[model samples]
Each structure stands twice: as structure tokens, then as C-alpha cells.
Target: MSGRRSPGDGGLYWDEKRGRWIASLTVGYTAGGRRIVKKASGKSKTEAKNKLKEIIRDYEDGLALTSSNETVAEAVRYWLEHGLKGRGDSTVILYTGFANNHVIPAIGARKLKDLSVEDIDRWLAGKARQLSTRSLKIIYSILNRSMRNAIVRDKVKRNIVALCEIPDGCEGRVSKALNLNQAETVLSSAEQADARIGGYIILSLMTGARTEELRKLSWSHVVAFDAEREVWLPVTETGWNHTDYAVYVWRSVRQGGDTKTAKSRRTLKLPQHAVEALRRLWEHEGLDKTDDCAGLGERLVFTTKNGTALSAGNVRRDFRKVIAKAGLTAAEWTPKELRTASCPCCRTPVSPSSRSHAWSATAIRRSPRPSTASRSTP
Candidate 1:
């Protein structure tokens, strides 16, 4: 027999500087007659040879063995840079924050190709001790998606993350839904507060509108039925004198001013309290004084005195004040919880199953407001 075992069989040798066994082979020759060599290294000949077999097997199965020696950090950065190309700025910011603060610090130094299911499992398990399950899932997705895209560009052979399951993490903050009594108190307190916040709270708690949706409300969307004209006109056209009123829940503070979903686009009839609150806001705004009621159509319904859109921080701060005034722990509540309690408190006017005052029998009246700014309605 010849010294070489076979033409297609691989060769094994020891690397002097590396002090490891190398399994090397020629898979093909380029058009220029240059030999294309592939390699896999290990501390022992048996380990190197077994890895070489896998590489050869994969190559024969039509997978290219051109993986780079990239680190987890590089892979993650690549995904963060390119993977989220069309995502919203807020979404990108959220993922970037999680990746920097959690994912990279944990396993950024590890080799992408060498990452294993055990590695991912262990990493997620460690994170579970410190993060909430939602946080853990987010970080896991960052790694998992990074490795998956890496495979598309031949950076790695497989994604071990897909094989690993996310472990349960610490408990996250849960939304606290108010019972009937609590809901009543919050509504009453809100009405007694500033008219702007009163309208905000009344609309939020009574209509079950999301905070984003409410913040994006415009005067044009606040429509009132014109009994004579038999058409819905903007609040600016009809003012608050009309009895039948509704709000077009067609916009939100999302990136493009879109509702959360197609189904989220809706029309909500104003409850008695919500109408009172908005009527108070209209008078408090004094657009009629400016004789610019026509121009108020495009103006946002809820905004700061400076006419800027209400931010999440702004809503939270004002909401806490109302909660505190209602004799509840301000720090423990958020604006979203009102949505949960609003479901039954508000019913569609036309729905046969509608029940009146399901949450509070106490009607919401226009609480007296004290503004330094002169009010024309005063």
C-alpha cells in the first residue's frame, strides 16, 4: 500500500507553536489550480480528526466551511447595526440598551462558532437570577437572532441558541387593576384636579384608551353629532354644545401616529364624565377667546402649556399625583392599569349587554379649577 491511505482521506499533523493536533485536507482546486485547504484544530489527534470529519461531512452536504473567528461581541454588534434596520427608534433603543447592559457583558468574549447550547443555557440561567423573565427573553432573542443571521453569512455552522430553552427569571412588575371603589375614587380625584389632567384621566379610565392613543388625540378627532346637519363634525365646528359626542380612536403616539393595531382603530362614545372633562378642557383652553376656534382642529387635545405633546414622563408624574390624591400608593401605580379597570367601567352605548355605572355610581362633574392664566369662559 502507498504511504498515503487514500486520495480523499484527510491528513493529521501536530502544530509546533499551537502545540495542538491539526486535521487538514484539500476539498477542491480553484480555477487557477490553487489548492483550497480546510482545517480543524484540537489538543489531541482524535479530537481534531473527529472535528475534521464533521467539517468534511458538512462540506459534502453543500454547506460552505468558511466560518470566521468572530466573537460573540462582534456578532451582537453586527446584528444591532444591521438586523434592526427598519425598526422604530424607540424599539432600537430598547434592544440596544438590553444588549449593552445584559447580553454583551455576560458572553461577549466567547467565540461565536464555539458557543454551545450548554453555554446559552448556563448564561440564561445566571441571568434568570438577576433579571425578569421578560428581560431574559429579550436578551436571549438578541443572541439567538444574532447567531441565526451569522449562519446566513457563513460566520458559523449552526445556532446552538435555537436548541436551548430560556429559563424562568425573577418576577416583573404587574399592573394593579383597581376595584370599583378605587376606580371611583381615582375618577373623582381626577375631576377635582386640573382640567387637562381631568380630561386625560376621564378619557383614559372611561374609554379604556391606551396612553399612547390618548396622548395623540387631536381636536379634529373629537367629533360631535350635529343633529341639524345629521353629520359628525369636529369639536371645533360643533363645540361641546352637541349632546351625542364621540372620539375617533384612530391615532396614537407611535412612530407614525398609527393605532397599535388595525383593530385598535375605533370610535368611542363619550361617557357623561368624559364629556364633562373635555368640555371643561375646551373652556379652560380659551380657544374661543383667541377667536381661533377654527384653527384648533389640528391642535392636540392634551398637551403642555407650551403646546408640546404629552410625554410618558409627563403622564406618569400627573397620574401619580391623582393616585396619591385618591388615597392610593402613587409609586405602585401606572397609567396602563387604568385600562384594565376601564373594561367594565365603560360599555359601548349601542351594545345590548351594556350596564351603566358598572364601576362607579358617582358621576364625574366638572370640578372647580384654579388657573393663573386668564380664562375667557370665566
Candidate 2:
């Protein structure tokens, strides 16, 4: 009797160079009439044949096996190059930095198709010992997003990262608000600063506006009169004449130029300090030299000497200078922390009632001050 033959069984042979059993099969043919072969190798004939059977089953299920050799690093680079179109420059820089500094250096040489859940779990576990929870989350997101993109492009069949749990990492930095004394020192230092940065610091601290929003503030948004009431005011009015001065926080530096949230897009009544700072800025920059007080040319409030928008790095460097002059360690301060410092100066805590009429308090409190124990003389 002839030996029994199973349907779709491939030929098995010994591979002398690899010293292993090899199973080879003709799964299909290319459009050009070329044979498409699939092979599996193992220590024994039974192992090789079993792997071949699994590969044949996958082939019959209509899954493509073309990206078996793609590496994790290549996949990440592809995603970073193609997936982040139209993202803000800062965002792209940040994402790319994380991918190169963390993800690519760790397991980027692994084959994308061969990546396993255990491999991901072990990699994350190792990272947890050195990275912060926030950083780990970011890297995990990068890998997850890259793998998903690869799957869409048929570079890989599955995202092994999705099957792995993120291990707990180290604690991130804690954010703190400046006490009253610190706020006073910063404001005082700003008073003696250049008009551009001084105005930015005053407006940010007094109005509690975000640094991003301040970066996008335009000269047109600053109001100084009430057209309806036909009255000349020291500050700009928004919608009505309830306040002498105000600013429209309708935009930010984010992609699409929208505020961080709908609640962040309200009108802010300028405090006396902010109004004086803006007046000094206008005179110092000769902004009133133009006839269009409404700033029809779309002039940015804060910019470099060459009229270009200031980068975040430029603003941070300038802010650090001011902080250092204020007798504070520049390393511990950031431009965004000004908003936190302004919270205590609010007449009322941020609430729904305060948000509807004005986004922040009209006046900053100057009493109940704390001693300047931590302040240093510059």
C-alpha cells in the first residue's frame, strides 16, 4: 500500500549548514508566474513540519507575510517620518526626541513580525527602573502608535505592544506655585526689565493667561476704549464698557491656533499693573507710531528684535534671566509657573461665576505677604 499523504503537506529535508530540519512549501504564485515559497526551520523534522503547517494555515487565511524582516527601528522611523505630518514643530520635536532617546535605543533591532508580548513586557519592566512614569507612558504611546501604523501599511500583522501592560515607573516632577513673596520679587524684577519681556511677565502673572496664549496675543486684541459708550479708556474694552482694559484670549500657539479649552477662550480684564506694563511696551516699541491702533497689520505683542515670533526656547531663556534677577534659582522656575503664582492674587478662587464675566480677578492682592527667606540677591 502507498504511504498515506496529508493534504497541503510540504517536503521536509535536513539543512546541513544550519544543522536543522527544514520544511519547504509552494504556497502560491506571483502575478508574473514566479513561485512564492514559504520555509520553516527547527531542530527536528516534526518541529519543522509543525511550523510549516502553521505558516500554510496563515497563508490560506489570506494574511500577507511580506514584512517578516522589518525591524522595530525601521517601523518607528517610518512612523515618525510619515505619521506626524501637520503636527506643530514643537510637538514633532518632542515625539521624535522620545522615540530616538528611549524607544529606538532599547529594542529597535528586534524584528517587527517576531516581536512578542513577553518581549514588550520585559522591555517596559527594564525601562521602569530608569524612566519616570510620564516618560514611560510617552515611550509606550510612541511604540503603540508606531506598531499600529505599521499594521495599517501591512508591515506587520499585529501590535504585540497592545498585549503588554505598562509597568509602573518612577515619580515625575511636582509642580508648585510661588508664594506671595516670590511673586513680589518676580514682579519687581520685571518692572526693571525690558519692555517686551516685562509686559509679557506682567500680563501673564496678573491675568493668569497661559504662556501659549500670550505667545499668540496680537496688538489687535488689546482694547483701550468703548466704542458703544463713545468713551476713551485707559484699557481696551471687550463687548462692553464694564472694564477700562481687557484682552481677547481667543487664540493660542497650538496647531490650528485655538485655545487649550473652550473655557480658556474668555475675555480677561487687565489689572492696573498689566495696563501700565502694556502702556510702557507700546511707547517703548513705538507701536503708536502707526495710525492703525487696532493693529491691522497683525502685529504680535511679543517678538524678537527682528519682528519674528519668539520661540519657546527664547522665551524660556529670557524668563530665566528675569527669575535670576529676582533673587530666585532660575533652574526651578519656568514661564508657565507665572500662572500658578497668579492664583493666590485672585480676588476670588477660579469658579464658574468668575469665568462668565471675566476669566480672572480684576485686581491682584498685595497684602498678607510671606517673608522672602528663599530669595537671593542678584
Candidate 3:
């Protein structure tokens, strides 16, 4: 026989061995005979009874458990593989990165039913102690969403992870950006390292172009009006530029997205120093490719020694070493930090213009705003 039914929800079941009341919600009408059962963890019957009531109410109202059969690991894989479809490539990559790096290692094997709110809270706390709060927040969100999917499908009684609190005061304040002296050191360092990297770094700092934008930059994107060049005057053309030569931000390559905002896609002008560096790079890489210029017009400015588009991972590793050798605190200074530290507003500004038909309209900005008060970690 069933225990008592509270108000509008399904009846409860009393487990003889466990000596507790479990929430049993059966849905699918008539001959279907499908049973959806949820349990509340408490020693006393009354305590479990009340919690069980809530689960039945939610279930009856159509919040059934969907992700019950799979382990947390299986659910996460499905979530990334299918749930995140139609999202940007970068989004998929980031989710995959976090699941593999943090979630799978910590709680992947645990059954969804075995995971408790307290267990999740403890995991998040540990992550907070080690990683940036931003990362933890992302993890929290992924778990919350993944479990929420389970709930709607009648797998779990509720999204237990939604109850977990995000760590407070864990994010470091924004402290990136280089002053003039530091900018010169970095630029000179890049110059001494390799003319190619030197020009790329200087252009990045000056134009505020994204690393990938520079990576995918082709000679076609840069239009020096022959008339303007002959006159030694600022060409009224714009591709992309920044107010700070040290801090450049353009588009995200991983996602193939444009600037994060309409304001971000505006054109920028380089300082005299940055232009000079670019001129040298153009002559070297440009000329080298011209003779064998098999793909001279492939449309990327920064390339590998073999003239293919640059990779972000390779650039970070190689550039960090170069920056360190150049006398910058390589550990604290990153390519991104260079852009943030330098004030591009100090450079010659460029005006924004629409790309012609020859240029593919692939410009779309990624969101610059980080997830601030989310329930998950990344």
C-alpha cells in the first residue's frame, strides 16, 4: 500500500528496509503504466514526506526526470555533442574543454542520482580555491543546464545543482594594459625576435586587432591607396585599428565571430612606429610570397614560416618565450595583456567603413561580457 498523498501530487511509498518515504510519481496515462520514482534523503518519514511532495508536484506539472539512465559523464558528453549543436564553434570547444579538464576528472563517474547538493557545493568550493572564480562559474552553469535537461526528461526530481552558491570575490579585478615604456620594450623584443612576429605584435598592439584576425589577416584586407602612399598622407581607408597599440581586440577565430559588439568592429589607425613596423613586415613576407606567390592572395597577413594561417596555441607558447627573452615579465604579460595595457586611443584613429562584395561578410562579434553571476563554473 502507498503512504499518504500530499494535496495535489502523487502518493508516496514507504521503503521497509530504508525506513523512509520515497516520492513515487507515475505518469503516462492508462495502458502505458510508466513509473517515475524520485527519492528524498532523510531519516524521518515526515521530513522525507514533505520533500517527496514537492518532487511529485513538479513531476506532475511536466518537470519529469530525463537524464536518469546516464552517468554524469555520459550526460555531459551528450550535452556537448547534441545539446550544444547550432552554437558557435568556440562555444562547443569551450564546453568540451571544461568538461574534459574539470568536470569529468572530478565527478564524471558518479551517477546522477548519487550526486548531492552538498557534494556539488564541495566540488565548487575546491575549484574556487584553485581556479579563477570565472571558470568555476562556468562549470556550475554547465552542470546546472545538463541536470536541468535531466529533470525535464524525468530523470532527476530537481536540478540539485541550481541550489549551489557561486563563490564570491574570487575574480581578480581587471589590471591589464601597458604603459608607453613597457610597450616599447615588448615591440623591441618582438623586433629582435623575428621581423614577422615583431610586425604582428606591433600591429596587434596598435590596431587592437584580435590575434586570430591578425592570423587570418591577408594583404587584401590592408588597402594602402597608391595615391595615399605616394602622397605620404593618412589614407582615408579603414580595415581595423585601435586606440591603444598595446591592446588590440578584433574578432575571435575559434568561433569565427566578429568583434564582441558594434562598437568593437570600428576601424583604427596605427601610430607612425606601428606603420613602420608593418611596412617592413609587408615587404618581407609579402615579397617572399610574391615570387612563389602561389597563394599570394590567400588573404592572411600573419602566417607560419610556410605561410599558412597562424594557430593561437602555437603563438601563445612561442610568443611567451620570446617576450621573456625580450626582458618582459613573460609570466604576468600575455598577448592579451599587451592590448589591455597599451592605450590605443593614443594612436592615430581610423574611421569605420563597410566591406565591399569582394570581402566575405563573415564579421560577427563574440560576446565580450563574461558570465558574471551564473550558477556554474567553466
Candidate 4:
């Protein structure tokens, strides 16, 4: 019965088809100049008007309305394309694989605004049954990051993934160490291999250096310390001579050539066997005379015959061949296990607290083969 309300006051009308009141308002215009209208329906005029007022208040409060048709897959794709700047290539590849293989195929079709905590929970639980715990964490991180990016872009109001808990997933691979006999066999087999493989195996097994660190080792980082001692000479009273060799584990193949951790950047004294193997490798490669090995000691210690860095796949394939020659199952071994094997080669018993320091000292003292007992004089 009231006079027609002004345009700014909004419009309320009866919908006889559905037997409810409808309220409508134009909040703004789209990029193409199309009117963007907001609508609300209720059983009574007051109820519909209240709903419209709530929407208007939200808009005035800076809440951008998202399209109901925008989907999780679109959000994820947008983040993958725009949000991954400065990330490493391997990391981007891994994230893309998880999204395409696991996330996108599952709940990616769900509307971004309509996605619920229950939906995320169910998806994670299903993934827990098949993927490892580490893998589950990676996928969850991807979803959480994507949703955050969507929120910043006004694609969604909130990130529902923040409310979901990550569940425990399938077990990951277990690492094992070689025993004394196995270590001896591996060393012996490595000694018979090509100079590069033999030197890499000995250095890795004896020094507990990571494969990644070894891959980035440069000749400049190799140092020889000279020891001074007093000698009974007619004219000279002292003599200085080289007593020890050490290698600086200061770089890795990771981005920016940074080690995995600050603690990983250390100087390790080379054991006798390791020094011998390195010497053989240097002579075999003719590094002493090659112009490539001139003033710049930055040349990599381990590489192909053509002086190029070896790929991970190439190293793994060559390592498996060495393992097979040692009479061990190649399927059960990896280059990383050599670090674990170094722990047991220590001659002295190591306390759990001082394992790191004691293990290196032990490796220096003990040889690959068992020592023979000395016979007492009669």
C-alpha cells in the first residue's frame, strides 16, 4: 500500500509462483559495465529485506562477492601459475604432479565458496590410505597455499583448508646400513671400479659426506695441512711436512649452492683409504697437467670422463653396478646408505651424545678389513 520506494532504498516484491517475498539491489557494475545485482528470498517481506541489508552491509565492509561458479580446480590452477614465483624447478614439478594426479582429480570440481571442512577431511583421509605421511603433508600444503592465494585475489572469502587436520599416511621407505663384512666387500669392489666411481664410494663411505655434497665438491676445497716437528739436524733444528688432508663440505647441488644446513658445512679430515683413492683419481684424470685444471680450483672432483658433472640417474645406475659386483642385491642399496654404514666402522664405542665426533675419529682409526691378532713372544 506504501508509495514506490526510491532506487537507493532497494526493491521488495511478492513472488506468487513460490509464495515468498523477494528483495533485490544493484551493488555495482562488472568490468564490462554489466549491472551486478544481489538478490535474497524469504517467507516474509521483512525477512527478505533483512537478508538484503546484511548483504549490503557485508559489501560496504569490503567483502567482495565471489561467483558461485568459480571452482577449486580454477583456484588451484591460478595459484600454480601465478603463486610459484622464485620456487625451484624440482619443487614446482613436484607440486604440479601432486595437484594434477591427486588433488585436481578428486574435489577440484567443487565450488571454491561451497568447499567445506568435511570435504577436505574426507579427501585427506582417502589420500592417507595410499600416500606416505610426507606426501600427505605436501598435498595439504599445496591446497592450503592455493586457497590462501585465492582469498587474496577475492576468489573466495576464506581458506577452508586451514580448518582441516592432516592425517597419518602410509609408511615411507626405510634406510639400512651395511655390516662390517658388507662394508669390506663394497670397498673392495669399488677399488676395482673406474677411478671416479671408486673414489666417490670410498670418500662417501669413509667421511659420511652426503651424495649431494660430494657431487658439488671442488678441488679448491681440498686442503693439506703441514705439521712441524723438531729434527736432529747439524744446521736446521726444525722441519715442516704435510701430515693430514681435509675436504671442505661447503657446497651442494641445491639452489644457490647452499648446504642442507649450517651444520652440514664442515671440514672433515680424510682417512688413509679416502686419501689414497682421491690421489688415484687425480692421477687418472691427469688433473696435474690439464689446462682445464689450471688456476681455477673450482673444477668438480667427481665427473664424467669429459669433465662434465654427472647426473643423479647416471650416478645411481653406476652405483648399482658397483653394488652388484660386491655380491649384494642392488635393489636393497642406495648411495645414501654409505653415510649410515660409516657409523659402524668406528673402532671405538661411541656414546649417543658424541656420536658425530666419535664416529669420524673411529672411521679414521679402523680399516675396512678386520685386524689380525698379534702373537705374544714365547
lDDT of 4 by residue, 1-378 (tens): 789988766778999999999888788899999998878789988899898787677677777655456788998898899999998876788899999999999989998888999999999999999999999999999899999998888788778799999999998788789888898789889999999999998888877888988999877666554233221110011111244456767788887878888777666766556767787888887765555543436778899878898777767889999999999999889998888884545323323322333225233322222112211110
Clashing pairs in 1: none
Q: What is the lDDT of candidate 4?
A: 0.75
| Worst 10 contiguous positions by lDDT, candidate 3 | 352-361
Give model 2's TM-score versus the native structure. 0.80
lDDT of 1: 0.79
Give each model's whole-structure lDDT: 0.79, 0.75, 0.60, 0.75
> What residue pairs clash in candidate 4, if any at all?
none
Q: How many residue pairs clash in each candidate?
A: 0, 5, 46, 0
lDDT comparison, 1 vs 4, better candidate: 1
Poorly placed runs, candidate 3 (over 4 Å): 1-69, 169-174, 228-256, 286-298, 342-378
Report the C-alpha lDDT of model 3 over 1-378, residue by residue, as the tens digit.
656555556555668888766655554445566544455645676877687666666666766544355678876776777788678766788888998999988999988878898889888888887778788878888888888776665567667887879885266646777787777677667777677777777777655566656775555334332332231111112212322221123344645456555555533434556656765776775454354433343446677788766777767876787788767777776676555544433333332221110012223242122122211111
The TM-score-based order of candidates, best leading, equals: 2, 1, 4, 3
In angstroms, the error of model 4 at 61 is 5.6
Q: Considering only N, C-alpha and C atoms within 3 Å, which residue pairs clash in candidate 2? A: 223-236, 224-235, 224-236, 235-245, 236-245
Instruction: Give the lDDT of residue 310 in candidate 4.
Output: 76
**Residue-level lDDT tens digits of model 2 in 1-378:** 436446577667888999999887787899999988878789987898798877777778776655268899999999999999988888899999999998898899998988888888888999999998888888999999999998888788777788888888988668987787788788889989998998898788877888999998876566544556544332222322333566667689988889888767666756556777787887787765656554333678888878789888879999999999999999998998887774444333334333333225333232111123211111
